[model samples]
Target: MTTIRVQQHAFDPGAEINSFCARNPTSGGVATFIGQMRDFRGPTRAEGETVAAMTLEYYPGMAERQLDDLVKQARERWPLDDVLIVHRHGPLVPGDAIVLVAAATAHRSEAFAACEFLMDWLKTQAPFWKKEATSDGATWVEAQASDDARAAKWKK
Candidate 1:
């Protein structure tokens, strides 16, 4: 089973994983990744400015299609038993959950790899724009070169 959901509300990653693992009887291992809102900006947290919240925007139909395509590619490349993806949009405060991903497989390697693959793809490929709200001002976030490089590692 491949489950993908784009929602505006928050989600619990632990519950999501438990539900998936409980339903998928054949999975011997499960891996998960959660993306969260960070409170700092600049070179590093210690030196960066404090951020209050972030607002994310996306075209609903297009975003879902993009996510489905990534899931399809993951399924093609791995012997995954199941995968779960849940992403939240709209305004979010620091420490809030932004996305959740879980990949289940017969072994730890597959589970871990697939879980990372989903997150890496989502970071670079997902169609969403984020605006960070700080006490001073708000700014749109650009994808970092580090994220691009990470995603490119699994390129075809």
Candidate 2:
């Protein structure tokens, strides 16, 4: 099973992982990653800028198509039994669950790698535009070089 969802509502990552594991009974391992909103951005809280809130915007039709394509790519590269990706949009506050990625496979290595690959692609390639509301004002989030470097590894 391959599941992809993009919505504004929050989701329970733990529950989603448990559900994926239950559905893939034959799979020996299930790897999952949950990305949550933080109060600040940058490497450290001391140096990072504070963010009061965040809003994500996207072209729904295009976002769904891109997510579907990402899943296909992951499946082609790994022997996955099931995959799930849930991403949130719209207004969000600190500590909100932003994304969930789960992958089940017969071995831990494949499951781990698939989950990592999915997250890496999502962070850099996903079609979501983010705006951060700071004390000063709101600013559109820009792509970071670190994210680009992480995604580039998959190309090789």
Candidate 3:
């Protein structure tokens, strides 16, 4: 089964990973990625210090649709046993896992590749917006051209 969830509360990666792998008899390998909040103080800010919090927002229905599309694409390309994606919204602090992607496959190579592919697609194409709160103030992080290029590699 494939599951995608968007929530305000935290999650247990170990539990999620275990649940994804438990019933899949055909899956021999499972790969997972967890993205965390980074304490980014922009170059212009005085005294480069840790960020206090990060606020994430997304268009509810649109974000879920986009993520489902990404997961569907992964399923079309890979012989995956299972996949799970979880992304959190609202305020978060450093070291908090922002998102999680897991892929289960018969082989490690496929599992790893699919996991990476999902993350790259999410980073570039997902409609989530992020703002960092620092001592100075809060600022939104712009999407990078590099991220677009990274996502382009997966296209046929």
Off by over 4 Å in 1: none
Model 2: pairs clashing at backbone N, Cα or C within 3 Å: none
Candidate 1, residues 45-148, lDDT tens digits: the string is 99999999999999899889999999999999889888889999998999998999988899999889888988888888889999999888999997899988
TM-score, cand. 1: 0.96
lDDT of 2 by residue, 9-109 (tens): 88888888888888999999999888999999878999999999999998889888888898899999999999999999999999999999989999999
Scored by lDDT, model 1 comes in at 0.90
TM-score of each: 0.96, 0.96, 0.91
C-alpha root-mean-square deviation, each candidate: 1.0, 1.0, 2.4
lDDT of 3 by residue, 9-66 (tens): 9888788877777877678999999998776564543656668899999889888899
Report lDDT (CA) for all predictions. 0.90, 0.90, 0.88
Which rank order by lDDT, best down to worst? Answer: 2, 1, 3
Candidate 2: segments with Cα more than 4 A from true spot: none
